[model samples]
Target: MDRETRYEDSHVSIGSFVLESGEELPHVELAYERVGPSDAPVILVCHALTGNQFTIGEDEPGWWKGLIGKGKYVDTSEFQIVTFNVLGGCNGSTGPCSINPTTGLAYQADFPFISVRDMVHSQKQALEQLGIHHLHAVIGGSLGGMQVLEWGILYPECMDHLVPLAVTPSLSAYGIAYNSISRFAITKDPEWKEGYYNLEKPPAAGLATARMIGMISYRTDDMFQKKFGRKVKGNPGESHTETTYDVESYLHYQGNKLVGRFDANSYLYLLKAMDMHDISRGRDSIAKAAKLIQPNVLAISFKGDLIYPPHELEKMFSLESMAHFYIVDTKFGHDGFLVEFDKWGPLIKQQLKETLKI
Candidate 1:
């Protein structure tokens, strides 16, 4: 299938900056797109892990399609929606897939390790380039939500409202363990070749396997049970030669779909960024970080989300003063925020209206 027509592409140049590993990154580029009228108040929508600027709307049905439109929850009639592929993302942004000026090839393993803070900093540069001095709201889910939290802490004066959905203040030990294993699966693949695989013959198998592992964590067991259960196929009496559990089929489809569009090296880089996310790191405490964000904060959690559970969200709320917490009771797990957009959309609209004074 042809890639969907993207929102208008734009870029910003970030000056030299030192990474957490003490590597100097000079002239980083941030690729972004904006929808609605430029005169409207800016609402920056950060995409989740493995997501792109299409978060708001795409030519195809996107994750947040229902939440953004002329008359939709985000109300393009009232707000200018800005979405960007994060700094280390594969989608039209500077990442491992981006050509390295020194070698004149994809950065691959040569890309500097990045943090969520670094991603937000690059986005800030994008916003500045666009002349968006202040934001009406910053909204996102999962890893995108992590960016929202970082924005609130790092640039509280830049935004009036913060909406972090289905996310946590930090990756849990269990979360890190699961991600590490997923990375191991990818890196161990014979085709990976330590991130130096041919561009045309990228490590498809390793990337697909990594995506399959992530699909399990993105949704709830209850959802799988309801949709697949223990039913099996593929034997002599089965329906098809490759048919197995429905969940397996689902994961396979998701994995294959991801490999078609994403780069394995970019996946590894973004995953490492997620692992490095710790709101309290180098700060006084989680509470101190929360205190710095004086905006009206909306922290939404999914009851069935094991990755970033409701309890973790509660802890994050406890660290803040103006946090309004909501648990989206659903069997969709961590992805509930994306799947149940109808329910959360209005809530987001209402909150933004109230907070932005629109």
Candidate 2:
């Protein structure tokens, strides 16, 4: 738990990892960032679909710095925080963009399909190599949250608590529909060329469009109406067809920003992995799968999230005997879990202080 400031050399190769699809990766390297006291309770912080291992930065603050820092909600001074880039990510982690040992070329479309279970298994393997056999708690939001749930189900004895924010036990049909459209946006792009596009001229337009589609579902219409409304650059009646909505412009900016840094192939792989997220996929019955979860659970949902609405969480957690559920309102919808820390930070802090004593 020596302080890691988003630097390099913090990786472990879990060799010849077999994926859920019965395919094997010759080498699966995981990049991780660990922070806080070496002897303190370890808190595994899982990143979302597009996030990396930098849970807390030194020169620059990390993404969740507001609620997880030296003296933030989770209090790094008292507990260790570890974050790792998920498989199929564009970051330092071995992903679709990584060179395939067989051909010395990027995996691209040739990358084998992976599921959430595969991601959890890979992380567990890496953790074992790093000498982290046990965790005090597992926490994350969105895709990260999905991983947290998987930990509780797959390795119940390895962790004592699970804190999943703004996520459901499984991806909903509505969520899958949105992801389908986004995947279509990327795969159908003329420049995609079956994910083997030239690195210099990747599928920027398609990737951007896919991100735009995601940005739409990540928030609520109520938030949009209040934040954007009918506002336009110039006069509203100047040119009806040409007047661009503020929301439309915002989405365009977000989409373009992701295109600059993220690999399209990685995005496609991660989206499919998310679509395959179900706690009971191989358990045969959801009730049987639920029986596998043994950790004390603290699940918080954003009231405005359209992707994983509060009801989805309620339906799944209702059967948990050791679960604590709370619905917090943040106008940002699904993205609220990343922002508006003030609305949900106290709930998590109280849970940790009251139960985990950290």
Count clashing residue pairs per candidate.
Answer: 0, 0
Q: Which tens-of-lDDT digit does each residue in 83-115 have in candidate 1?
A: 889988887778888888788888898999999
Candidate 1, pairs of clashing residues? none
Candidate 1: TM-score?
0.93
lDDT of 2 by residue, 266-339 (tens): 89888888998888787886667777889888999997898898987777778889888989877889989888
Best by TM-score: 2
**How does candidate 2 fare on TM-score?**
0.94
For candidate 2, the per-residue lDDT at 211 reads: 94
In model 2, which runs have C-alpha deviations exceeding 4 angstroms? 1-9, 235-243, 354-358
- Full-model lDDT, candidate 2: 0.86
